[model samples]
Target: MCGIVGYIGKREIKRQLIEGLRELEYRGYDSAGIAVMQNGKIQSFKAVGKLSNLDEKTKNFETEGPGVGIGHTRWATHGKPTELNAHPHMGEYSYVVHNGIIENYREIKAMLEADGVTFLSQTDTEVIVHLFEKEIERHSDLFSAFKATIDQLDGAYAVLLITQKAPDTIFFARKGSPMIIGRNRQGEVFFASSDAPLIGEAEEVAYMEDGTIGYATPDLIHSEPDALQFVSLSGDKLTAQKGGYRFFMEKEIYEQYQVMGDTMIGRVLDDDIVFEELGKTFLEGISRIKLCACGTSYHAALTSSYLFERQAKMPVNVEIASEFRYKEPLLTSDTLFIVISQSGETADTLEALKMAKKAGLKTLAICNVDNSSIVRLADATILTRAGIEKGVASTKAFATQVMVLWMLSIFFAKKRATLDNHTVKEELRFMSYVPKVLQKALDVHEKCKRLSKRYLHGHGFFFIGRDIFFPLALEGALKLKEISYLHAEGYPAGEMKHGPIALADAELFTIALMPKTLLYEKTKSNVEELSARDSTILSISPEMFELADDFILTHPHKHPMLEFFEMMVVEQLLAMEISIRLGNDVDMPRNLAKSVTVE
Candidate 1:
């Protein structure tokens, strides 16, 4: 997930572009660059690393003439995170900053090379500017060349172009990634990847839908009327402040108790769950579900698979979005396709959603972003009220996704009469306790922090559980591996004997999830087997296991879902603490960005 900021305004070009890039740096910070029109020429400055580096490079530089420029904070995809591979990539006549991958860039680069074009950098984005230069030679008109170049590309992108031929305007196009255009009463136009950078800068904003190509000048903004989705930014502010926490991940882990309430606020009625967003005819004739997602969203989907089947009596199939399209699986009208993503701009999940729509299957999206590509493309959407999840590992988003999906299962059960009204009401009552359960879960934070030291040195981590807890175990392993740079795996407790148990030893640390409400004895017996193998067991449960080397006791809950929430907090805090103790970036992990906008 790279950040894009472009301005055609009355403000100082260098300061405005750099400040905007600073606001959007959380999207990416591997490298940063800016390009502005100065003295009838395209002036560019680039630096590797954070926005601070770019700011330092441009400290003595100033811009003259009309205020028009484009800037980028890159999360490298096609090339290494070096100055040569940073954004604001230039061709003979155009400079471009791009987010998302161009799948067919190699073919187009080959074609451009054969036509005597020299490339300066090894980036998929460099092909865009070169292609634009080639198309400008053929079309002559700037907008025509922009669309012509866009038409030739074969993958996801949100591109901002500044050309010497048309220095007064900033031409842009969005295919799969996110881009927003904003303007104020002073006739200043702003473009950013999200509303974060444009919040205080512009009075109103419009999200550019997929397949949209347009341009923004100081005095005017133009796009196809039907493609512009405008919203007034009267009081919208970036709410991703860390407050008093050391990192956004820490703050987000503690936010679950509050935001989870936001997810269920209006939906949880006295005795029924309602999704007002899903109109009367939304779930009609749905016979089965195919859930597609990647990474932690995949684990959330896997967790929901159990809920949909056990509670709603609905058959479910969960697939990793990256692998879903390659399998050539059957897609049918009776099967409702659901995709989950925290950013909603995940490349694989978005592509999977498109493929399902192409096959004519009714699609639903569970996402946090309001109008992301997947949310815009899906037939229906359940927006997770997790707000903005700034952490790359995702703590609140996963909890909210599973929370919403759990509610969806109950809603389905009530609608289909799969569960009696009393049972449905009981489920609703349990759902209401989630916020409190999450608060109690946070009580284990100190314990998790204290235990983090013991987990620092280990051969590898094994997070094991059974049934629904199995998915939670997988999520725990993912969190540990994500920020701590540790090798970890999650497995069904019973499957440990089959292949995984061979590595069990004193150095192997096992994090066992044993919720008393569901299959606790079976999972405990499995943990005991690992303990017998001389594995150091870290038991997370309401009851203390005597065979464990360490124990992080959780509050016992009436419902298994409540225990799941409790264990989730334990897992998240433990991972964060371990990462912190190891001197790793808690919020922004290496080799990873907050959003996976490219494959």
Candidate 2:
């Protein structure tokens, strides 16, 4: 849930770490810190609040650092996100930084305290440096000290260690969290939580497998896996972060076109779609389908349920993984469970998948992260090719997952005879039109900015829709409330009178997720009802709903089957715009981390 950067090269390390921290801010953090071993000492600096605080603190200092270093932007699972808890924890001689939970830290701390290792902070991370110092006395070498310290660390972690004794080397290790190493032809080696730091300097990378350790030296990256064999290495990009965009979200939004292009690269056919990985027998044996996910992934599931129900004629249950696990769902032996997670390591979703496996159900995981625990455990997995999404609020990953589910539904429908081969082919043909449509959506930036400023203060926003589009309404309101600091609610179009009509007064801003579909009549009537109550109407439809006398906006038009993707993009954009208009941090929202790794 945090971002880490470490370097042991002949270049300045603070700039590399600060640049990487910008990408990692979406993971969530209240503070940032960095430690550099230069001039025979470990120099450390930390600041409370965004990475900017740390940047300001170090701007006047000599940043011409050519030494070993480590930096961190925190997510605060162990303690409050304060300068004291921010990483790059230092001891008498060693400095260390880490990500993921150190579950056995207290026991280790008591043991160290008995040895006269004084405590400085209330963080589980601090113990790693103290332990490293203790181990250094026994081993005397940096690599041996790292090995001893890690052997005693019995929880999830991605650690980077350095000291004055080894000013030209950086020792790193990982068990559960992600870490990667990049090396250049000149022998410059660097390490990071991801390959975000070596964008322009070293695009060559070898993503470290779980339980792997890396020692970064000026000349080479020495990688050792705790388990077995060597892995393939490749130089991906000169800069692996966001290309040249100001924000990861903007770059990711634009990459939707590339992501979708790659996803649809070769599977299209004249009359049907085929998944190269899923064997025909897998579909042949399945009956009903269950889609499990959480948050944005869950919203994608709801959209996919419609595709399966209509195009495939399959009874699909789109259930929230947290709620679904408790229900102990009525599953058949032939039921095919499809779980979606961007990280492929969602805690509740992974647990729910385990229960499905125990019930003897065939399972398929749709994930972005390749070969993750969820992917390894599933019977099979459909890998969505969207790359790393650093923003706390997901963008490209959500769009790509929805596209995969839609394509899967189309393929399943053709096999099940719910839709003719010609119909499925036509749907795939229409999907090629998404990129241009999304570009048009991005053009309305000024309009969204104005909307957020004008209606930013609505006491409660009510979004209305009918049928499956109702979930889009709920999801839009959810995103808005999450980052925009607005109280919002979504209701089925026909359910306005059941209980929500009482709050549909002039003070409320209501948005209708209506498209030119069968439920248009029901959605139109809801707009009329809101108009009668004098509520501010913001209708989201391909064509404006005339009944609502409020400002009108028409999202990019798509075939009824593809309209929800367009709708989702609109809401996501609006939520982000509104968050910024209100002066709230868009990337790092309050009380939220991009990934909920811990309970």
Question: Highest lDDT: which candidate?
Answer: 1
Model 2: residues with Cα > 4 Å off, grouped in runs: 1-246, 555-558
Task: Report how far residue 482 has shifted in candidate 2, in Å.
Answer: 1.9
lDDT of 1 at 14: 94
What is the C-alpha local distance difference test score of candidate 1?
0.86
The residue pairs found clashing in candidate 2 are 26-392, 199-238, 199-239, 204-235
What lDDT tens digits, residue by residue, belong to model 2 across residues 1-599? Answer: 46788766666767767776776664445578988777667788999887888989999755464677788887555555577878888888878888766766889999999999888888888999899888888985778878888988875678988887777888888886677776666666666765555666564666666778757667645667543232334343424454545456656766676566545544554455757668878876788999999998898898789878888888988889989879857889878998999887898899989999999999999887654678878998886766667667788788888888888888888788888767776887887676556666666666776777777785789877877778778888887877777898877889998888888777888888888855777778878877898888888777766766454355545486467666667777788888887887766678887766654
Every candidate's lDDT: 0.86, 0.76
Candidate 1 regions with alpha-carbon error over 4 angstroms: 1-240
RMSD of 2: 15.8
Best candidate (score: TM-score): 1
RMSD of each: 16.0, 15.8
